[model samples]
Target: MPEALLLVLMAVLGAAVILVLGLVAFRAAGDRSALAPPMPAAYRDDATGAWRRGTLRFVDDRLALKGSGGLAAGPWMRGNLDLGIARPLAAAEAATLGRSNLIQVPATYGTSTFELALDEQHYTALRAWVEAVPPGWNSQVA
Candidate 1:
């Protein structure tokens, strides 16, 4: 009788532990889901130019590009271009004058990072502009 009671107690404790673990797991998943959805692969604008928006989450040696948008899900590239192309002339100026290339533009809501390459002529200009941009400038939407 004592042995049976011991076994029952052990079983009850095991079940309680399992239940607690399951609840913890569920809570963690819910928290992760609460984070904003990843950015989208491409965003089409009425103005012009190709744009790509996504998150660059770094984990150790690997980086994740999470695309956003509802209906159509996009691919996750190793190195995602979070920012789309700027307007033609704007892009040209950014490229010609800015040497570093306009990988990401400062925005109000979020930082706009790009994957496009720029010409050497724009290198100096691009570098200067990028350097001048205030930190957190990308957090603004406009």
Candidate 2:
């Protein structure tokens, strides 16, 4: 009976250790959604010129941005730039612009993505610029 009791205790202890380790691993992964702050409504105006705004719901791993008329289906117009980033926004020019919109740059320690909002004209201009550059030209973290 004593031997059986000892075995049970050891098993319980092992399980406890496993649970602790799992929790630690989860914490290390650093879920972004949980850390995201409430987005400001001031950035959601449609009258703003060439301004891009969106909420990076880190919890959902999604970036939502607004264009002119505060909708994505609006007619293409100049001074509009709407885009999304799947991977973390590079700290380069794109990232710099993101900061102007109050976007928090993701840490380089893990995989991250970003989303963008722009007017149609601005989007076209940005696309053209990206295409004009050599492949792999913007690989550096922005």
Candidate 3:
């Protein structure tokens, strides 16, 4: 009985050591991503004009959108498209007389338009990316 108990204890100890090492490696990977440049575009909108944070990454000429993340900052949705595939639009929906429109992307599911809440810096960055994207398939739904 004592010998069996010793074996079990050894197994548990080994598992714990492996878990700790994996966690350390995961943290290191996260740090490496931090070294990369910030996303070229991030925009948000709220009724009151308060800044809303969202992930709009441009890497290797691809766009990545991460909505509100989970507890560990995992993106709720992850999608990327070549810069050539994105079609810039003045407005996704018909503009009303006083409508304040925010940036909109025509995602696979349909047009996803953000609310009007992005700060000045983020808004400018978004415009730069949109204007730079080369014309592609007419994805911008009329």
Per-residue CA lDDT of candidate 3, range 1-142, in tens?
A: 9999999999999999999999999956754554234442333332233333445544434444444551122221222221123333244231321223444332221233333223345556644664565556356758
In angstroms, how far off is 85's CA in candidate 3?
19
- Which residue pairs show collisions in model 3? 45-115, 45-116, 45-117, 46-116
Ranking by lDDT: 3, 1, 2
Q: For each candidate in turn, give its C-alpha RMSD to the true structure in angstroms.
A: 15.1, 15.1, 9.7
Candidate 1, superposed: residue stretches over 4 Å from native = 37-142
User: In model 2, where is the ten-residue run with the lowest total lDDT?
Assistant: 104-113
Top-scoring candidate (TM-score): 3
Estimated TM-score for each candidate = 0.26, 0.26, 0.38
Q: Which candidate is the best by lDDT?
A: 3
Cα error of candidate 1 at position 63, Å: 28
Give the per-residue lDDT digits (tens) of candidate 2, residues 1-142: 9999999999999999999999988855643333244232112233222335442222232323333464532222212233333233234534535443323221111232223444333444444533344445447848
Model 3 C-alpha lDDT versus the unseen true structure: 0.43
